[model samples]
Target: MAFGIFDFLSLIGALGLFIFGMKVMSDSIQKVAGNKLREILEAMTSNRLLGVLTGVLITTMVQSSSATTVMVVSFVNAGLLSLIQSIGVIMGANVGTTVTGWLISQLGLGKFSIASMCLPIIAIGFPMMFSSREKLKLWGEVLLGFAILFLGLNFMKEAVGGLQNEELLSFVKNVDYAGQPYIKQFFIVLLFVAIGTVLTIVVQSSSAAMALTLVMCNEGWISFPLAAAIILGENIGTTITANLAALIGNVHAKRAARAHFVFNVFGVLWMLAVFPFFVNLIAGASVDIFGADPMKTATGIPAALALFHTSFNILNLLILVGFVGFIAKVVIKMVPSRSEDDEVFSLDYIGSGMMETPELSILEARKEVVKFADIVRRAFKYVPRLVTEMDEKKLRYYTDQLEKYEDITDRMELEISSYLSKAAKGELSSNGGHQVRSMLNIANYLERIGDIYLEISRNLTMRKKKKAYFTQEMRDRVAEIAALVKKSLDLMVENLEAYERDIDFAKAEELENEIDETYKRLRKEYIKKVESGKFQVRSGVYYSDLISELERIGDHVLGVTESLKKDNELIVEE
Candidate 1:
């Protein structure tokens, strides 16, 4: 086993190219699908069946179950999807992940054929990736990534081809731990499981682990049986991703982590039961696939590997789809998250990876904005509480949190808009793509709404700091206007969600017109009364500023309402 410079350099180069290729492909796919991946994930309610289906569909499409599951954890943490719902998806993900194994098995990477022809695609793709238009660049990156990926596989396969000679082959083939018993094999598998688990956890990508498996398989360093056992271990090990992500999560969120683990462990258990039988089955079939000759190499069909990965996953998906509820219950029993538990979003919906998908990211961002708006509204609620000049400390705490949420709203606007721009650069349908753009606009307008309310809070603080108070008649008007302001903001928030399901432009217009008309008349009357010396200058100045701020709040409300129509056009120009 003398190492040569060529082999050493080739191996290092192949792994580097492999990792880079995967990244380019994943990023391109993400942008192309954008938040669409999140949308597919988000619709799974408490229904285990739908969750299972959603999980398989998403993982298969994204080509990375780990990414999908991580995203699930994020959604769970965000209060978007329930633990029960996520469990089914995790089960489906395990099945979907096997598709990779099948793909490698089918492709095989055996010889000189179409496997080598993809090189030009990489050549052309990288140049296109540097374009000014995001779409062209993303498309180029995806193609380039795919070409590099196949090239890496081809290089790895070719490097090992030299090892196929009799002496080198016999050395690797004669390998055996003669004294090792069943207990030792079990421990050996466990050790590999630990290694795979550690690597996946550290790298945060199961594809890396799987790629390692492919290399080992190619080298004949591990027989198909041993490699298959390790692959099985890898599947169970990947569940640690979502579980670790749920450490700071709520009951439902914890349950999702538990469910991901539970589902994976269940799959491993079943495979263990039928391990010998399945190995024999695959061995019998592998002969027909590569041909009956032991020395006969069919390295040309690289897709065979991919096919094997796909088949294993699809079979698992079919078998386990019905068992989702039982798995969900086990996770519930394992991690019973109560409603009273520190729920950040809903009981179990906020997964950390919620921000991963462009589409789902926006939804989670929107959910966050809604919560921020509530904080703003309650800050207004704090205004009424401000009457007795309550504890300064508590007031500061409340205002501080409200302001923090406002700050968060600002961050979300940037994130949502940027993610949307990336998403728009990808492949999308007319309506689906427009929705991505729409969500971005909503995030921006909602953020502006937060800014306006936060400004009001500042106004209140200024008034209190100045020890300003309204006159008797003005006090009544102030309270009335506060009521009006709160009402207007509430409507704006409510209508943000409403207009999506059903358009009510007329009603919104009417509210704006009424607020404007009332503000004009009130200002005119206040000015006349003040000029007549009916009120002190201090009161009049306070009134004027207060009325002006309130009127500006009304303007913001109108702006938000109006922005809905222009939602789709907002991001494209920028």
Candidate 2:
């Protein structure tokens, strides 16, 4: 049979179905274990070894190294995982991704085909997908995804099977490296490796690329050595996902992504130098383990390729694990940090794209929220400065800063709210949904606090314009209330940074009460002073407005803490 356009389209459709199934399974598993996964990543990455194991575990569960590496990059971006810790996880992900090859070899292409049972698996999973329980529903999706994945693999096999005898494959069949010179064989392997790299980059999934390589090898279109060469290329290509994700991330995130590329490329370079020896070793192991020689038979290629993929990554990891710190240093040197002042307007955690699981995305959003709290707290400092400055240029400078800070707060709130809204639309647990709602509320409150600061600055500006100078007593009273509001803002930030259960709202509430009492006392005193002609009426009006704005800021600070508390309660109820 000729390999016509429809056959090629079937190949493309099968690949798409396979990718969709992998995405569904990966996303559903993440939703099911989102919080636990976050906790695990946070706790387990303290050391390099544990980090690697965590990487392996997560990649195996998700069945996609690209997903694991991108998650690590985002975590690094969020400041959840340090660069050194992320390096270990990336290494483990390389090893963990080998599981997919083993699965395909042992199940899909093995003597007892899992594809035959795919329909039955789908039948079992379909009803559970509608369950009210979130966990059950997610698990159903996982089963459905798994079934769909192998079904696509089965279709891919049939698609490729049709082209086995086509003239198009004749060129591939004729390219024999058996008797080529050493240098010629080396170049041939390099060509195959390049082909693998392009294939993976085009598909955007190394697992899918590996499936194609294995399928082609099984159908006798490619030899074991050529297939192995492509596997090496896939390793290099998989790092592209993390690098692309890091394009919008911060400096550390870029460094982490570069570290993945450096580590994988270094592994490939060393492996290429000993390519023939390693291929022979894997072939020998395949004969011992599976009682089949991949070099001489088509049926043995899948298992041999799986073994080759796993062993190569494990060997590369063992060789490079100790140099993780060295790799980190290399990448750091490759991508240096700019000035901290330069990053004032940019986001610290959240990036432009949804690069990871919804859980990790939420984690990034939470970090950005903490950063938002800090920004407002810093902006509040300028208010006191604006109130007390006497030099016209200095006052103008402070006012400009306040305006800039207010603009930053507005942008931050909008960006965070938009990111959270997108996340809410994804598959989230009840707890995650509640957390998103809480974060949205907190961002609004923080922005409002910024608005009040700007209002105080405006009041101070107008008081100066009207020649309504405050007496020393009035200035002292304004400073006193400002100090109280400052303390409340500080407490609000602390509550935001703390774990929900550990967040003590007592201090925040106490500060709010103090600000309210002080506002009332200060207001009455100002009215009495104006009536007795001790203070100018114009000055008193501005003073009273300042006190009111400060009081309103206190209310907004309390709103942030209360929103967090409410979110915690909602999660517990679920």
Candidate 3:
């Protein structure tokens, strides 16, 4: 019987089902553990060993190394994890992913089939999906995903079982390197590795690719050594997911993704050099455990492949963990930081994609909000420059910059708000919900502060156009109020950077009061000057408008602190 197009399509469909089920399980598990995962990440330290352990724990919990690496990239992008720390975690993730192969070998392809119980498991979980409790609902989804995954695995086994026909068996015999020369076998292994890499890249999920590889091996479609080679290729292919996720991320994120690629590729290269010895060792171990040679029969191939996958990653981790710092240096050199000018319009923390972990996404959005505050602070500096700059060219430059900054602020607010809204739609914890609200408020206030700067710039521009010059006294008074406003803006950024409890709300209030008092006194003095005709009305009007806009900025800065305080209180109450 020939393997027809329908058979190939069925195989593809089975793979898709497996990938979908894995995604469902991974996403549900992340939602269930989101807050705890955030706490774990926050509690992480500079200890590389601990970082590796954390990676293992998170990957085991989510059942997907791709998920773990993407989270790492997101965290690094948000400045939560350093490159060195992320590399260690990535190494651990490599080791952790082997658990899937073992699970498939023992449960899905073992003597008793878990797929036989898939329908019953779904029956048990289907009712709980209607549960009112969010946790229960998510748990139900996990159960359903678990059942569906094995069911798909069973389907793939049945589909691959069809390839035992004569035509395909002939092709397998041609490629089988069991009695071939050692040099020929090595080249064949390289060819299989390339195939594995392409397979993983196409699926975009190493776990799914591993499942397919295991099914193919269990059905006698490939030899143990070739399956092992494919596993190695999967390691390299897995890095592609993280790297693709980091395309829109910041420099640090790109570095973290590149580090994953470098680490996995390095491991694969060294393993290739020792490929023959390694497979022989695994075969020996399999014989001792199962009393069967995996090379001679397909019955023991699944377990032996599991052993190989686990051993390869563990040995790779042991061999390279010491050089994590070295790997980090390599990737940093590979993906160097861009200049500040190049990043002017970019979002440093939150990219276009949302994280699987909602709480983590909130953290990223929060970092982006802090970045928003800094941009406003820098733009405010341009405001003072526009006031004092006498050269036409310099003044034009500063004015153009302020206008550009104002547009940037608008975009930042829209993007941040859109991100937070999307995050809120996810399964967020109470604290995450509060954070989204607070970040929204902060972003709005920051944009308003930018607008006030632009307003002051426009007033100054009109002043220049009308030839209404400020007397030294008028300029100095405006300068004094601008200084007070600048101080308040700096305080706002500081509060944002600090922990919620550490925010100096008292200092913020003091600056706000001082600015209010300064505005009132300056207005009173300006009225007297206008009444006395000591200042021209045109100049006095522009000066008053400048000080008023400056005072408004102080108000918005205070608003930002207030929002932060409110968010902190809500979290405390929760």
Candidate 4:
């Protein structure tokens, strides 16, 4: 108990080792399980029941409920998973997290050396620490991680056990909250909450807090009632990571974080309300079930901790699931969906996106790319309206909006360009690396299309201001080119997300070729009219630019198709 400064540093060194091992282990485990994670979460809904289930399953796999919730938030932001479905995922994640407690309970926390001999666990693991291969180094870190996790726990137990010889025993034996009445215990709960929150934020791992809880309980330093309260507090505090991530995220993402905070807060409140009653109830159950005697010293602390985690999450889910829709509604109201009128484009996935994982990031970036492609579709959408309307004011308004759409494309190009740049800094698989390239290519062509739209909008605005008129033949020719380009842009955007799922792209290829031929034919017809002197050169100016703009947009479509073709070739190479 009279440890010196050197002893304290030794303990700090042990704790740091524990954290390093945990990180290595979590990373390796996730890489092993990564392929299956996405498939499981793909169709997760907004309802509470399914939400809870998704959360549980994901938490069980990742072994961290907080990680599961963060993934759900990222999914919701990407427009893959909606906010409503995300609520359920959050609830389920909380429930799923209890399995960790269950796992911890099942772990033979007191065992390990037999398997170590044949493996010479340290021999294999130590060299791996110095290995040149990155993957092996990661794997070695994982093995050494397991070694160090146990090593630190061993150190902690020995250190704490050493305290049993001194005045620390008398200090530990006292029911420190003895003088604390309801008001006192209430403040004590606040203290535990603060402890849990700070520990989780500092360590950035909920499991570490749980591990610390286990250590404290094992040391007989904290009563079961207080430990359980701290356990619940850990759940709430663990959410701070995601909440921080969501601060700069989209509305849906922010809602996902809000739901996490709400879920944890409700769970903690419910537990606090029934604290003493449940403490006695679980203690009584332990008495009969485990032959535990509360009259004497009981070491069923681990079981008690596990019970509190599971029952609390289950209870919280049962009560809060129904209100999930309302949670979504509240979040939506608080963080309204971005409208085109409000911003250049909806940045639903930028910072809040779960796209940090190479696989998921590629998917999210593709969605934004798809949205950008749709800008070209909107340009196409405007063509018919432009041709059908005769009012100068109406035409001008449409042109102005078209200019706005073009501006949106400019912003989107920059947004996605920046997003992909950040995304590329991580280690990318060959496919992911290529998708990054393809995405950059898409943005470039898209920006060009936007530029073309700007030119067309400027010409249209000029003609409207000049009060110039075009004959019916001229209008028909321009409309024909616009309609063709519109079709190509539609197919191009659709192919972006749909490329893999779409088996028969021959028709898409055929249509792309048709658009190519149509642009050439239109160009010929425009010049014919100009040569006949039937079309004024000044009138031909705007008409010629419109045709060129339409042609270039069509070319971008073909470029997209070619890129898809190239992506396939690369896939083949891989």
Candidate 5:
């Protein structure tokens, strides 16, 4: 019964299979009910109680709390969920995750152990994968995932059972001291806690970690209390996945991940203070409820382990639920918001998001576009102010701000384009691809509008530097053109935001034509002013730059509108 390299590799391979099964199963479930899941999560997580319930329900259905937390983080990143709402869901996810332990208790350790049922399930599932019907194929995938998951667990259990390594067992047993019981117990618990944390981090799935712990306990490799300590560490380890996901996210997203870590670590902290007593309680409950002593292998410890996992989370939630606001405040302090002007560099959403599902990815991309449009609108609003400011200091301030806005738009376009390019690699419907292409084109146009603003800002800077200012009439004409371009931009955004339905497009075309006519008329009038010596040539040149940039911005805005209109039509045909 030697634990050789092949045995170790088999164990690692088994863990990989378990993780793979979890992924496949989780993804299929999401695909089967992704829209409904979104609707439920959005509609149900409005309050603390509903949010908790939504978390529990979603985690239980998907059989993975990590998936639920990642989704919640994605929602926050997408502006679909607030930080507070996310906190509530995260708390409930802690409770929901225990369901996996209970499932293993029944399926992996009972008379109908998962090991015994894996092949029959796979036999039933294998034919489903080949079904022409999409729904049947998805169902087949789910069944196969279940079978593979159990097979992996069984392989791991068998591998550990074969490792009757006396040296390892002796070290585990020697930690207890007869004269100093509390000291000995404390150190052992801490050691197991560290072990559990490392194990969960390496596996990246608490469910798999829990399964392995149960297998070790079932084989008498660890005591029930020791397993309980490891389980506590698993709670802390599970938070790492969400935190890793939040790295590319905005401040709010980072805060949500921090909140998750805070919640779990607090749960583990309090549990450690009363470790022995709590384990005893769970061990007693296992015997009373299941007619089996958890410490004895023949009676089964999986039930006791599951009970402990559930009770600990439930009690932890009850104790800390009232302080969610306090916890949120703490995380906010840990990660504060950026200063006003400094905050304009990056996109606010779609960071650390799940792009495995193209449908959801597209929705996130659209939100980023909406944010992009709003930035462009704000930048345009500053145009007339830039022109009218007479104080040199204020004029310089305005131009500098506009320049920053242009840089912001450029960064946003690049980041979002990169995101969409990755999303395009995922499976998508024809309509989905069309929508993505349109979003890319719209981003390009919006970026061009930002360039136009920069151009206008530079012209104003030149005018200010040369002591050449617009005459009242010239200012009035320029303002008129700016107002028309502003109108076109607003219309473009409206079309972009409601890109699912049919847009008039006629109104947008009319606006574009009017802008062109106005530009021609303004050019003619300004040239006459230059010829009559009513306007300085240098002033006319700057005026021509401003007017031409405004007209081109109108054209780009129109391009965005047309792209939206075309995308909407394609969606309609679908």
Candidate 6:
């Protein structure tokens, strides 16, 4: 029978359905268990072996290795996981992904019609998905997605079986390279391996590729060995998702993805070297131990292939587990760190598609805010240096640092605020929601503080360009106010850092009072000096602007401390 356009469309539609169902199921599950997944990943990936276990658990729970590895890359980008730990997790993801093939073997090939089985599931899930309650709605989606996944598989199986390409089968069986079985078989394996890799890359999902491979095998369109070779290629192809995710990330993220690629490629290389032996071992175990019949290729082949997938990953993991350090080092060398790696103004912990875990995203936002505070502190410190520097070159250098810092802080505030806003729209507790508002306010105040720093730099630049010389008395008084402003900023960051802990709110209030008093005293003293002809009136004008901006910075810092105090109280009440 000829493969026609209708059959081809049916096949493509089935594949599309399968991919859609996978995304729905994976996303719904993540919505249901995102916070718990975050906690488990954050806590469990502390060491190499534990990281592997965490990877397996998360991939199995979410039913998507690509998701797990992408999350791992995000975590590494966020500085949540080290390179070695990420490698371990990547290894476990490979093993955990094999679970999908086994599940298909059990569910897709049963005596009952998998497609028909999906009807009741969708029937039951449809109403719940649109229900008023969010919890029930999420669960309903999971059920609907499960039904759709298997329904697609059922369609694919039927469509593939309908191909009736007996000529193709005959061609595969009759192909020989001058009667050299080994050479012919080797080329066959290599050809299918390339096919598998391309299929996975096109779909961007190894589980999908594995399902298609199993379906093809179930129809005896390909032998089990060829299917296993495809599985090997799928492993290599699966790394693409994480690597693609890492493209917008930092050096550490790039290294983590490279480690994943390195690990899978190495596993494939070794498996290729021992290809025949590996296949035979898995084949023997499937027949003798798992009750699968080796002579029967069509009936028991999927399970045998599943067994091959599992065993290959497990053995590969065992071989590479001990060399995680070496792998990490190699990837680090491969992806060298750039100066901007540490200085780039982007969110490290939060990324796109992470709003599902709102509470967790808050934590990420807070981490970014902490980094923001540090940058502001550095920017503020340079203000005084710029004020005192008389050398043109030094003044320009300090001014540029302040300008860069202002831009960084501005971007950081926007990024963190945008993340929080998105996360706030998700399911969150009242306290979590309130904390988001408070964090937003804090980011706003921090941005204001950054603006004030930039303003100070501008004023200093203007004074330097005008060649305005301050009286010794005016300079000394303004320095005192600037010092007090620095103290206030320091207290503000401290309160934020120890948020939810019993903080010394009074100390922050004290710094604010000091800033206020210093500004007032300096303003009065400088005005008197100008009136008494001890300082130039132009000098007093610039000095007053400087002290006023310093006072404004103090005000914003106090605002941050106040927000932190409220946020802390809410945490305590909860």
TM-scores for every predicted model: 0.58, 0.66, 0.68, 0.60, 0.66, 0.66
Of the candidates shown, which would achieve the greatest TM-score relative to the real structure?
3
lDDT of 2 by residue, 494-528 (tens): 88899465788888889999999999999898888
Per-candidate Cα lDDT values, in order, are 0.63, 0.87, 0.87, 0.70, 0.83, 0.81
Q: Can you tell me which runs of candidate 4 are displaced by over 4 Å?
A: 45-48, 105-144, 161-175, 293-298, 337-551, 554-574
Q: Residue by residue across 1-574, what tens digits does model 3's lDDT show? A: 7899899899898988888889988999999996888667645766889889998899989999999999999877655577887898999999888899888989999787899899999998899899999999999999999999998899999888877775855665358677888899999999889989999999999988999888888877888899899999999999999999999777788889999999899999999999999999999999999777899888789899989998988888899999988998898789876755324555667755678888989989888898899888877877878777799998987787787688778878987998899899999888888899999999999998878777877889989999999898987887899999989989898999994657899999999999999999999999999999999999999988888888999999999999999999998898
CA-only RMSD, every prediction:
11.9, 12.6, 11.5, 13.6, 12.6, 11.0
Ten-residue segment with the worst summed lDDT in candidate 5?
339-348
What shift in Å separates residue 298 of candidate 4 from its native position after superposition? Answer: 6.0
User: In terms of TM-score, which candidate is stronger, 2 or 3?
Assistant: 3
Task: Give, for candidate 2, the lowest lDDT window spanning 10 residues.
Answer: 339-348
Q: Give the total clashing residue pairs for model 4.
A: 9
Residue lDDT tens for model 5, 1-574:
5667898898788888888888888888887775888878756434788888888889988889999998888777655577878999999999998998987879877667867778898899889989998888888889989888888888887777777574655666445422358978788788899999999999899999998888777777777888888999999999999998898666777888999999999989999899888888887878888888876653367888899999999999999888889998999899888745433444556753455598799899999998899889877877899888787787777787788788768867876787788888899899989988999999998888888888888878877879777888888998999999888888877877767664669999999999999999999998888899999988888889889988999989888888888887787888
Of the two candidates 1 and 2, the one with more favorable TM-score, higher being better, is: 2
Estimate the lDDT of model 3.
0.87
Q: Which stretches of model 5 miss by more than 4 angstroms?
A: 166-169, 177-180, 296-299, 341-574
lDDT of 3 at 343: 42
Weakest lDDT window of 10 consecutive positions for candidate 1? 293-302
Residue-level lDDT tens digits of model 6 in 1-574: 7877898899989988888888899899999995888777666534678888988888888899999999989877665566777888888888888888887887886444467779999999999998999989999999999899998998899888877565655664343422457767677777767888898999999988988888887887666677788898898888899999999777888998999999999988898878877787888888886687533567678888888899999999999999999998899889987754244444456644454578888888888887778678767878777767778998887787677667767767876787788898899998888889998998999998888878888988888778787766666777788888878777777777877775789998898998898888877877787889888877778888988988988888888888888877777788
